[model samples]
Each structure stands twice: as C-alpha cells, then as structure tokens.
Target: MICALTGVFPVTQARAQQAPLPEGARIVVPGHGWGHGRGMGQWGAKGLADQGKTYTQILSTYYPGTTLGARASTEDIRVLLETSSDVIASSDQPFTARWSNNSIIATSDATYRYFKETWDGTNYHGGSIHVYRGAIEAHQGGSSINSINVLTMQQYLYGVVPRESPASWPAEELKAQAVAARTYAARRKDSSRAAGSSYDICVTTSCQSYGGYGTKSSPTSSVTVLESSSTNSALDATAGKVLMYNGSPILAEYSSSTGGYTAASSLPYQKAVPDPTDSVSPHHDWTASMTVSEIEARWPSIGRLIDLTVTQRNGYGGWGGRVLQMNIIGTKGTTTLTGYGFMNAFAWPGRSNGLQGNWFTPLYWRGVLQSAPSAVTMYAGESKTISVRITNTGTASWPVGGNVHLATNSASSFATSTWISSTRPASVARNATDPTKSSVGPGQVAEFHVPLSAANMPPGNYSQRFALIADNQSVTSLAFTVGIQVLVPWVSEAPNLLTNASFEPSTYAWR
Candidate 1:
C-alpha cells in the first residue's frame, strides 16, 4: 500500500514563528506528517536503520503482533502497468509479445520507443521473456485496454522495492521495505479491477508503484539492470519473508512518513506508535494555504465561509489523533465533512494549493458582530456605565477569565482613570440578571459594561481604539475605533448616549 489511511484527522494550532491566519486572511493550515499514518513509515524505517536497528527490529516496531515467516509459495504476481490506452513495449534483448488476437511480435535490442498499436481481444498470460524475467500481457475490456506485467515474485520485487523506497537508503531499511512490500503483494487478492480481472496489483499510488521493465528507467546492460543495487541486494537478502498474523501473511501496509507518530487503524496489528525517527522526512512538517474564495467556490452551498472547525479526533498520534469530522460554517448554511472528504473537496492535483495530509488544524477568518454605543458625550472626571455587546464569531468559545478582556490598542492615548491599565479597560462581565452566563460560546453574545470616562486629561475631540483581547493577544477583527467629546463635569448629569454607530454633533454646557 503506497498510502493507507489511519485513524482520523486532528490538529494543534501553532503561532509566533508560525503565525495564525489573520481574520479574513487567506486560510492557511500548518500541518504535520503525510499519508494516512498507518503501518510502517518508510522514512521512519530509514531513520531507525541509520540508528543501527536491524530489519527485524524495524518490522517488529511497526507491525507489533505480526510474526516474520517465509512465504507459503513464490507464485508469480501480475502488476497493472498501464490502463485504458494503447501499450507499446519491447525489451533489452530478444522478447516476444502476444496480443489479445493471439498475434506475436518478436524483437531484439529494441530501444523501447515501443510499437504502439490498437488492441485485439485475446489475453496471453504466459508468453516469452528474457529481460527482467518478466512478460507483458494486454487485456481487452469493454472500451479500454489494460496492460499488465507478469513476473515471478523476485523479478516483480526488483522493479517494486526501489520505486516504493529510496534505492540509496541503508541496507536494513531497504531490507525491511522489501519484506513489507513482499507481504503486501502476496496478500493482494487483486488490484481494484473488477472481479476476475487478470492483475494482482497496480503501478500506481492506489497500490505499490512499479517501474516497468523495457523503459529508459529499467535499462539493462547484461550486467546491471534497473533502479537500485542496494534495494536489489535487500530484496535478495529478504527473499520469501512475509509478516504473518495467525500463521498467514498479514496485509502489510506501509506509507512514506508518519510525522511524529503513527495513527490508529481498524486492523489490530496496524496500531498507533511513536515514529521519532521520521523527522528526517521532508513531509514531516508542512503548511498549505487556501483562500476563503477558493473554499466557497468549491463548496458553493456553504455561502460565505465563516469557520472551519475540526470536531472529533482519533486520539492516537499527532493533532489529538486525526480529524474524524469537521463542521464548515458559513453565512448561508453549514456542512460537515470527514477529513478525507474535506481534503478531496478543497485540495487536489493541477492546483497550486493541495492539502497534503489530513493531519492539520485549519485556522479560519473571523470578525465580531459588535453592538455598542457608538456616539457618546462624556463628562470629564465623571464615569458612566456603557454597554458593548459582542457576539462570539470564531470557532472557540470566549472565556470570562480576566485574560479575556477589552483593551486599548497601542496608539490609543485616551486613557480613563477607571481603566485597569493604559491598555486594558475591563474584563468580560456577565449580565447581572443572568448570573449563569459565565462564558460566551460560539454564536452566543456577551455584554460588556465598562466605565468609559473622560477623565484625568485635557478634554478635546479624540479618536480612540479598543480591541477584544484573549490571553494578551489582540483579536484584530474585533478591534473598533471611536471618536469621543470630553467636556468638563456639568452638575453630575448623565452623558448623552446613542445606540447606533453614527456620531452626532454635540452642543453641551460645561460647568
């Protein structure tokens, strides 16, 4: 298996050196690991091999309960090399190919530019071959042709192991891959072809990849042939070994990398485990960026994207396991999708932004629904209670901890004597009538009644800015600016307050 899906999806958000996506900024995902996070991690195997672990140790670490044993038989395996097309192929030396029409073409030293021709329906499994110890067979389907490579297990692996793993990796790593690949291949009832198809596996990521013989890549000089010497030697060393469970070969699955930890799997043997060595993999850490427009474009029913939140995780490795399901919040409606469903929807090939794996936390754009007294005249040295209603719009709940409060921005010089500091004005306060409203969750509203006074400074026309703060971080989209008129105290009368955002010209008498 080139990529096997493990438990689910999940994420732990990061910031600072890796900053959070600003509200309404293009959505960016800081992610960890790659693949489905199942079974043996190839890069991890290499790292462990470099650390002096043997092939058996690497296998044991990944497939915990499986036993290593020799294969029951070394039957030939069929690999689907090309599908739905005309196949033109030849070998290094003398080789013969039988078409579906029972026609035979024999050639020698052909450069393998390939002799392309239309298909005639007669399938041949056993033909003649001297190159790579394999033969090419073409099958006729309803409307398309499927080209398959027929070869013995050893010859099959010669073209397989190197494509699945790096040919230059340490001997133990290559050997471990070879064994895993062999077991996986042996367990293949068939490739994703319809039942009773002619092939056992495929040369795509859908299955283990294969570099077919008779290509420029699979060159032969009568002395050396194809990809890697180290990988071939590893194949030879681990000849018929397979990972067996209950005395039968287990469907050994392996992926490129598992970030820091492997994800859980439905199969008991493919358990979640720490992969400390996989830091060497390039995909161990990654970040993918997609825009709000792109998301709404793909999932149009989700009108304007408001929030992308991962709800449940598998509870295994990184990101609190893997993401199981997520809610896509939008102005028009909401849509829930599994991790794979979301990835398949938003990210894909042929696009610049492709979400590599499901192991990620999506940080989205957010803005507050603020309802506050905008136009106001305050008496200097006199404080009055004002109400500001804040609707929680982000994915997280707004806690009432003193850490989450209303604060002044750095540029604000209109400080009032009642403020906690030059920066902080007041903490999130509850409605006295509703004492149970301790914290504000998503979509809920919280009321802030803070003392906004025109005090301790020269009273003049002033512009001031304040922001909703959480744990010392300013919520940028929640920041709002206001203009105020500060007059000298006038007979202790209450100041004029307006509910709407528009400010009106004030003609007031000063004491």
Candidate 2:
C-alpha cells in the first residue's frame, strides 16, 4: 500500500481542522513485486521447481501456449564485448589473425594489442580461447570503437545463462533459464542487425547479462576466467532449443520475480498469471516513503499537496492492481500521471527508492470538498442555487457514470423537500465544459450545483450533507455539509404612510 507521508492530524474532523498539516508535509508510499513483473519470474520458477514441477511445466506456466521448437544451430550471433578506441586482443598461445580484407596476421603468444579493422578468424589455444567464433570486428564508435564478438548462438548462451540465473540453482530451473535466454537472444539477433549495429546484442543488461569466456570475470574487466559446470551442462541439454509461438522465436522476456502474479502485457504469452512461488523472492514486497515537498519539487505543477489516488489498473487483479494511471491532487490543480510516470516521479533520492513495480495500493483520502456553499438566508418559497466544488484526491479515477448526491438521514429535523428535492441525485461531471456530461478523473474537480427551492419550508435554519457515489455506493468519506436559513416573507405590523416624518425620543413613530 502507498501512503502519503504528510504530517499527522487528529482522527476526528474537528480536531483535524484545529491541527493542519505543517508546512512541507510528506507523502509516503509502499509497494510490492519487482522488475518489470513480466514473463518468467526467476523466483517463481524456483518455487515451481521446489514444488516438484518439471522444467517443461514451469516454462509452460509462464509462457502459455508456447512450444519447445528446434532451430538451426548454424546461425551465428554477434555480441558487443567492449567499446573503445583501443582493444587489447591476447591469447595464451600464438594464433593467426586473418583480417577482413583477406590479410594473414600472426600474433605473439600471450600478448595484448590493438587492431584497426576486422579480422577473418582469430583462433587462440584451440577452443581454450573464449573470445568468439567467426570474426572479431572492431567498428568505429563516436570518437572511439567497439569490439564485437561474432560467434554461434550456443556459444553466446554459455556466457549468458550463468549471469541471468544462478548456476547453482536446480538443474531444471537452469535449463528453463537457458531455453528462455536462448529464445530471447535469437529474436533480438535479427532486429539488432537490421538496426545497423555491428553486434546482435550488447554484453550488458540492456539486452542480457553476457560475460564472455570465464563467468568469474566482470563484463568490464578481462581477467581470470572461470566457467560453471552446471550452467554449461544446462546449455548443452537445451542446445538449439527455443520457445516458439506460431513457428517463430517468441520474445521471451523474464524477470527476477513477479511478487505473486505476473504483469499484463500486449503479448499473449505474457498474460497475468498467479505464481504462488513468487512469494519466496526477496523483492516480493517492499515499501518506500517521501515528503510532499519532495514530490512537489519534482512536479511543481501539482501545487499544494492534497491527496493521491489510483485512477486505473491493468487486468492483473492484484492488490492495488497493476497501476495503469494515477492522479496527484494539490490545492492549485490536479496532475494525471501514467503508472510508469508516477513511479519515475518518486525516483528521487530518499523519496521512494523508486517504485519496485507498478503494482501498489494508493492509501489516502479519496476526495475533498474544496469549496462549499456558504450559509445563506432566503425567504420561504424563494430559490437559491447551491454549488460545491469537490476534488478527486484519491488514487482511482472517477469514471463518467459515477454519481454524487445528498446523503440520507431519517432523524434530521428538516424535511427532505425543504431544500432542493427536484435534483435528488447528481452525477460527478467534468470540472470544466459540460459538467453535466463529462467525467471527473483523478486529480480533477467536479462542481455539483443544485437549485434549492424553499417551497414548503418553515422559517428555520437547517444543515444538509451530500456525498459522491460510484457503483451505486456512497463514498462516505467525501461527504460534505451545507447550511441554509429560511425566513417568512412578511411581518404582522404595517408601515405608516407618513413620509419623511420623525417622532420623539429618537424613535421613528409612524401614524
């Protein structure tokens, strides 16, 4: 749940009115899940494995309607290792460097040097050298150059699987990871080439974590090399295997965890699904808080802070649902932010360590009566237009069909028709243009106007309340009250016809 960290106030309205939020009130938000909440959840897979589910079952659950398919192993993939003007190419044993222009260049044993252009094939210490297959191309980047490794798809998976999922994980889980990573890599290979890049994918998180040769060395450093036997075995087991949908390699997107339910996506395979095992993940649930001042600092247009509400959600059906849209309400105006935008807004330091995922509950007041009709005295049988400005200060959007009407109180002294009885109920309309028709979204205000007629009212003062209604239910928290005084039109005594005549004792006695 997301809670605004504004200053505390009394529980009762009267006391809350006496103690207002101090200057610079804050908003605190807490949330759940992690990553993009898409595709195969690593932790969920682990959970399934722990529950004795096979790798095939786990894959089928995450990637619905996908089938295991075989692809040609002949197609090679290009991976961008490093980008720099100078690249150190070395090997333990002497190797031949064949240039792109069909030039043969021999390298000294155990030495690193820079090469200007492309090479036909650089073989080092047999297959002991873990650079890449095919040829290594040194493409010129802006003011520098990039070192690309063109190799078979299988060789690329050897560097990717271990980094994406732990090599020590269950053999089935590792196999699942290998297949998914392979499928993902294959789909991106062609697209990357079409984009006019030297490599099919990068050796970073932008594509997938790829550590060449030894898994022990970092992507940035080319040091000691180490390989995990388990990961290598998984790669061999799933060689040339990929997840395919409609006879094509699917975009197999995977994340660390999905909390409990996967996110909704346009892809049919990425639909929302419940994973009971995701709870075992560390980032299954998390929370963060921030001040109103901090949020306002990021989005000053929100003006004086009021409340936050969730306007729309995806079809995932999780708590707070996967936030699709949100409304940030302030005294000056309201700002509508998409779920992703709202998460980015609180990405500031000490605000919310950033929203883990779009799934989170917005915990705050739903609406506020910013302006209400003042107490007025009107003659019995007269009419007055009573209007109130109500702002949607919650996390949810107020749809077009929602309504706002007077509250019911059978014990009230005043009769129901004493005020406005004709417009018994009113719908929440757009704050601007055609309030009677348009809908009031989150952070937006709706003005409810009712023509109050004192038709059969007695000479007395009365107080009435109104509330916002949605789904045929009254939003009691948003209810507001208005005051009215009805008076008789005439007095019993008649006025004397003596014009401009004054009587004694400073009292105007007319005769």
Candidate 3:
C-alpha cells in the first residue's frame, strides 16, 4: 500500500518488505488516541471502566467538584445551535432542563443520570440521561421520565440556562456547576489553543470514528472533541486562514465505529460552496445538444422544426439539492428558439470520481385544446363533425377534482357554449401522488367533440390555429391547422344570346 502527494511518494509498504523505521522512530504514538486528554478520553475511558471506575466518578473527575441535582420546571425555549435551519419546540428548566445561553449549567441525581438537554436562551430543559457503571448500565431512562434531568456531554459543552427545579435544588445548586464546567472547555475555538482543541465531523463516514464495542455507550466513554474549535484552527493555519486542499478547503471528517466517514469543508455559511464531492456541486462545465433531427423525428408532418442546444459551465443549482435549469437554443437556418429544462447524468464533469449525477426535467403540465370547431376540412359550406383528441404529456399529472377547459374562438361562446362538457374530474379518481393537476404523464390523452363551422369560414385556402394550455403543469401553444378551399362556379352561353351559369358543390377542394 502507498500514499503520495504531487507525484512524491510518502507512505509505502510492501507485503513482504521489512519494517523501515529506526529502533526509536515511531510514525504514530503507541497510545491509542489522536486527540485531547480531558473529558471522555474514549479509548482511555474504556480502559478505565475495564479497571472498574463508575460513571458517577467519571463525571466528577472530568468536571471536578460539581453537584448533581434534578431538572427545573418546564417552559418553551427557542434554541439556535450551529446556525442550523431547523427549529425544535423545546422547554427550559432551572435545575434539570437545557437552554441556550452563553453560560449556564445544571445537574441531576446519580440514580437518574442518563439525560439530554436542549435550550433556546431563557430556560434550561433536560431529558432522560444515559450513563453506564461498569459492564452494567448505571442509569437507563428508557421510556421513563423518572430519570434525572442531567446535561449530556454536548449540553454541558454548549452551555445551559438554569432555573428553579420543580423542587428546590437545596443542597449543591446543579446549574452553577454545569456552567463552570462548560466555560472551562469553551475557549477551545481560539486559534491560540489549536494544540488543545479538536474538530468533530458530522456523525457519518465523513468524520472520525469512535471504535467502541456494542450498542450501550458510557456517557463518559463517548465524549469527543467539539468541531468548532478544530475546524477553525485548520482554517486559520491555511495560507490566508482560508484553508485549501487542491484549491479548496480541506473537509474535516468524523467516523462512527459502525462504518464509513463523513466530511465538512471549512467554508463560511454565507456564500459557501458545496462539498466538491457533493452531487449538487459543479466540478466542471459541459455542453449538451438536442439535435434538430431528434425533435422533428419525434413528430413529423410539421414543416417548421426547432431544436435547442445548451452550453453550461457546470450542472449545479436549484432547491432540494438539484441541478440548475439549463437554457436550450434551437436554430434552423434563420429561425431560432429557446427553452429551459434540466438533465440527469451518471457522473459530473472534470474528475472521474465515481459519483453519479441524477438529473431530470422539473414537472410539466398538460395542455388543453380549444377552438371554434372540433374538426375542419378543405371544403366551402359542408358541415362536418370531428373529434379533437388532446393529450396531457406534462411531467406531472392533471387534477382529479378540477375541470379541464375547452374554449371556442367566438367571444360569445363562453355564454352560449354552456352545453360543452367541461365538468370537474371525479375526485375519487385523483392520483395519490398529487392532489392538484400539477402533473400530466406522457401520452395520456383526452378528447373533445366539436362542431365544424362551414358557413362563416370562406373556404379559399384558409387556416386557423388551436391553442392548448395545461391547467397547472406548464403552458403550451399548440396550433391544429386544417386548410380549407371553396370551389368556383362555371358559366356558359345559352340559346337566345342569354348567359346561364351553374354552380356544383364538390367534396374535395384543391388548393
């Protein structure tokens, strides 16, 4: 196995090669830790518990001289942690609850130690605490609320607001002790304390892992260095404190004993670029073409065909972590057209890192057809009936409880064409995916019967356009063109010098 940088070899070892380090040269410390020496030492904690140190003693040793008590009363607290977008409805307690404060603390009884606390600003609210003794659990709240409302390692670090418990914390005020412990470890974010601080990654393969055994965890055994401090230091040490790795911030990682790693780059919340490997980020720019033949071939008989080709720097944009809309341009000789849509791919541009980019067009609506006549023919005054078939080909389906519309070119048709069938679709038949007719699947067809108007249309090579607009999916302009022509009469000379003419109707009108 080998690791390299800039074509320069660094770490390498052959399966049968002799170890190369000198007698005293150690690449890594023999001790089983790569982080701070305080609080929950992880590996060290396991070792300690193996030697039989109780969890209560473990907490006391880390916090030093602190009292454990019950949670205070319950009142809602507005919590804002890590600048996250989610807001959870929570409460605060003076002794037992958790709260969001620059500084505060509280504790619970040893018997009910397993606890979790979250706070907004005002009060400290707490939940069941989970702690371990030796191989056995000292406190397992399970579904019971009887457990003490003590702060977990996280709550203790973030700081909690303390208030009066339902019963007075008469003996040793739990809140004050929690605050003192929090402040002790709070300044680790300062650059000057890099040696003492550590970074914590999101709880995934993107981060460092805690290689502990089994499901039950000792509260003291699982403590880890906070992310804020470590990430900031790495960022500060970078050329301009703007950490970079191959021209981008080096993402920090945290691993759970379970599997894989999770990572987070050192970018500010404002205008921060997405992780390079993120499916939503743009690694390179590329262009795609939808050929003219492709569209024309899809539907023939239309003389004018337009095709659009798009060129984009990269495929990254949109909400719900999707690609940006791509603008397409179609040009046929002197005619040009433009449209917007998206694309899906198995990978991104630039690198060959095996990440798949699944892109597709957003939802489209079905268009309805409306015209004066249902059908038309190339004739002068011959009344004919034709059925107009319309299809909803939008990416989305149509509404079940809403009416599909059909209109005639006549301005007074709205009042006179009340007899036209434009009833709301049956609600029972609505698709479960969408209640609104916001989507219309491809090839789903709808039809309407219309009467052809032959009297007003002067059949002399005339044509009219029918338009269709989808209810909620998308708006489309459809032209159903039918050509019509009127036949001319023939005149002949009769006896007595009088001119007689006769007109004969023909079924076919030649243009």
Candidate 4:
C-alpha cells in the first residue's frame, strides 16, 4: 500500500492569500471511491429501497430492458401434457424417465413402441422414430428415458425498450462513430506488443460472481449464451459512452462491472468479470487511456498534471503486439506525482476465452525519500557506539521484513573483524506496526543502536554504511562515519625517531 511521491509542495498561506487559481491550471481532487461507477451499484441498490422501489423494479431499472427469466435448468418447467387422452391406455405401465448421473434412458419397451407407433406415418422430420431412437444411445449407462419437451426453466423477463430519441443521429451514424473510436483506441498501442496474455470468458454463476441480495429463496435469471465476436463491441451507445470535454465522442470501453484496479496483478478468477452479453463482431479491439483534458475535467480539483512517459515495446510472444509503458506524472497543478500506465495487446485468434486478454497491470507508483546512518567510525582499540533512525514521509509506508546491514571499512585493510552481537543487528527488535520495522509506517520511525570495540586497534578514521535488504529490493540509510583519532609522535629525524608508544592522551603516538 506504500506509494512514492514525485515532488510535492504544500499550499502555503501566501499562495492561498495571493490569488485565485491561475487560468488553465488544474486542481485534482483526490477522489475517494472505488471501481468504475457502473451497473447495479451496491450502494445505489440499497438506496433504491429507501426510495420505495421494489427489488423487481431495482433489477429492471439497472438492467435496462432486461427481463426476469427462470434458470436454464430446473424441474418446474417439465410438463405432462396429454392432447388426446383416449389415444393411449396405460393400465399396466408407469410413466417415468429413468436417468443415470450422465444421461436419461427409456426403460419400458412399450414406451419406445408407443412413441414409435405414434410417430409412424406422421410428418416427423422426414424419418422414422424407431430409426432415430436406434441412432441415439439407449441404456448404455445405468438408466433409461422417455424424453419430453421441457421449456428451459430459465427465462429472462425483459422489459420493453422505451422509444428512442427522435432527433438523435441515425443508427448507422452511431455505429460508424463507435467503430471509428474503437479502431483508433486499438491502434494507439505504439511500440509495446501484447503476447503471452491470458483470456477469461465469464458467463453464468461459474465465472461471474453472483451475490443475490441476501434473499434466502434462490432466484433465477436467464442464462446468457456466449457468441464469439470478431472484435470488441460497445456496451452502450447512448448511456455509458465516454465523452470528450467538448460535445464529441471518445472511445469508451464499457463493462458490466469493474472489480477494481490495484498495483498487483489479480489471479485468474479473482478479478471482476464484465457482462458477457456484448458482441464485438462490428467493433475493433481497444486500449485504455486518459487525456490531459480528461484528467483535469474528471478531477477538477487537481489542475493540469505533468507527466514523464516511458514507452516500452515489450510483449510476450513477439512484436506486432501490445505495448507496455509507465508515465510518471505530477498530481495536477501541484508537484506531488503518481504513475499511469497499462499493458495492451491486439486481439488474436482464440484469444478471448480467458482472463489474460486484457491485463489490468496498471500502476499508481510514487517515489519516496529514504535516509539512514552509515557505519560507526571509531579508533581501533577504542570503543565506538552508533545509532540510526529511519523515517517515512512518503504517501506509502516503507517495506517491512527487510534486512538491515551494518558494514565498516578500515584503513589498515583489516580483513578480520568480529561483531559482538550474537545475532544479525536487524532482527533484534520488533515493531507492532511492522515486525521487520523496514516498513516504517507513514509518519513513523524506527531506531537501532550498535556498539563497536576496536582492541589494540590501528589509528585511523573509518567509514561505515547501514543498509536494509528485503529479497531483491533494498534501501540503505545514509552513512554514519566515526573519526577515530589516534595519538602518535611525529619523528623529526632518524635520531629523533621513537620506538615506544606515547602515553599522553593528546600526543600523537605510533608503533
């Protein structure tokens, strides 16, 4: 959850008292909400009840012309219709369709004979019923069956579409505009290529998550049939379309829902799945983007955000695919920053069947300032003590569970050194907020102290640096240097040379 910030300056009293916002500058308000505001808003659904709307009305309104239908497979729709009761007598027969777990089979030979006799000499598919039954498997498993016409239990009770606007553009114009927008959106992927992407098809309750408003009675809706579309299709032309600042059209991708966006990639079934009823046969694949104007208009509080774009021609399979890039941008007119980026790929054959087709690997990255004390500098044979405090002022917290390193460099090129602490210096302390203490909470700090004793040590100034290491990620604190000043006598000449060490504290002595 920790995020870095680019450059941020607080709005001071002077700026506030100076003047109104400069023209053309944008102020982006950090909107506190999740997901793309779309169909069946959970909060909105609850609000419907407050407004005195029934559950039926709520579903109908959100679905817009979709009807309530029974579930596709169920027992309620089976029938025993008898058009002519006198035509058949079953005094010694029981009417039943036996079935194994796999399939159903007809047990009674009389039942088969009756069906065959009934269909004989009739206009039944230009073939005999006996011949047809012979072609079909019977009693292969542990069951028999007499098939009956069963209305699919599932039914979508669709509401009639209201009349369209009389003055709106004709259907053809709308379609063309949508197509153009989609085509343009798809082509915007410059150097990046899309390869090794996965795809997911969400339909029914299997792939799409279904939460029935806490109703105990299991409800059913019409089963949505999947149709392979050659390309992407617009979810809504009049309602959910993304519009430009002007009264113009913008390429918009509509989903039944947006699970949410996060810094880490989501698992196969963990992400939110879109409504599967859309058809892409007419439109082209598209990418996601945000214009400067769009950002300003959408986030009116944050004025024109500045951004540094890094475009990558990276794809899994090879070139002529999706592109990947990261754009570091300042938040609005102010200097605080964040990253905006996405990886997109072209639609290839058999690519629309899984979650990999559209990777939501978007990042909202930021930079943070880190500081630490280097190694403790002390005179050889002298005792030295050092301490460090790590703080975080960034939008996010520092990483937790990282290693803390304490290193020292000696002037004598001394290869042998022993640390008194039995364990690694980093693992001695624990924090409630972060056990590792590496992830110092935002506005939080951690401190550590280390003692070094140089016995019979050489006289010299030594430097040391402390570092934090977590797996492949690491951040080192500033270096803490200790100047070990040793007293040694200065020899004027060969006759004045001193072989014994000077005992005075202030005198410079040497061996």
What is the clash count for each candidate, in the order shown? Answer: 7, 19, 55, 59
Candidate 1 — which pairs collide? 8-322, 8-323, 9-322, 9-323, 10-322, 10-323, 100-122
The Cα local distance difference test for each model comes to: 0.70, 0.68, 0.28, 0.29
Q: Which of the two, 2 or 4, has more TM-score?
A: 2
Tens digit of lDDT per residue, candidate 1, span 217-295?
A: 2223243345577888998899989998987778788888888778766777988888989999988888777766777
TM-score of each: 0.67, 0.61, 0.25, 0.28
| Candidate structures ordered by TM-score, highest first | 1, 2, 4, 3
- The sequence of per-residue lDDT tens digits that candidate 3 reaches over residues 305-346 is 322212221122221222222322222232222111222221
> Comparing 2 and 3 by lDDT, which wins?
2
Per-residue lDDT of model 4, residues 84-152, tens digit only? 212221212444443446545444444444333445552423211110000111122124332222221
Flag the better candidate by TM-score, 1 or 4.
1
> TM-score for model 3?
0.25
Q: What residue runs in model 2 are displaced by over 4 Å at the alpha carbon?
A: 1-24, 96-99, 104-135, 194-196, 215-223, 347-352, 364-511
Error of 2 at 501 (Å): 65
Error of 2 at 410 (Å): 41
For each candidate in turn, give its C-alpha RMSD to the true structure in angstroms. 11.3, 15.4, 24.3, 21.1
Candidate 1 structure, TM-score to reference: 0.67
Worst 10 residues of 4 by lDDT: 156-165
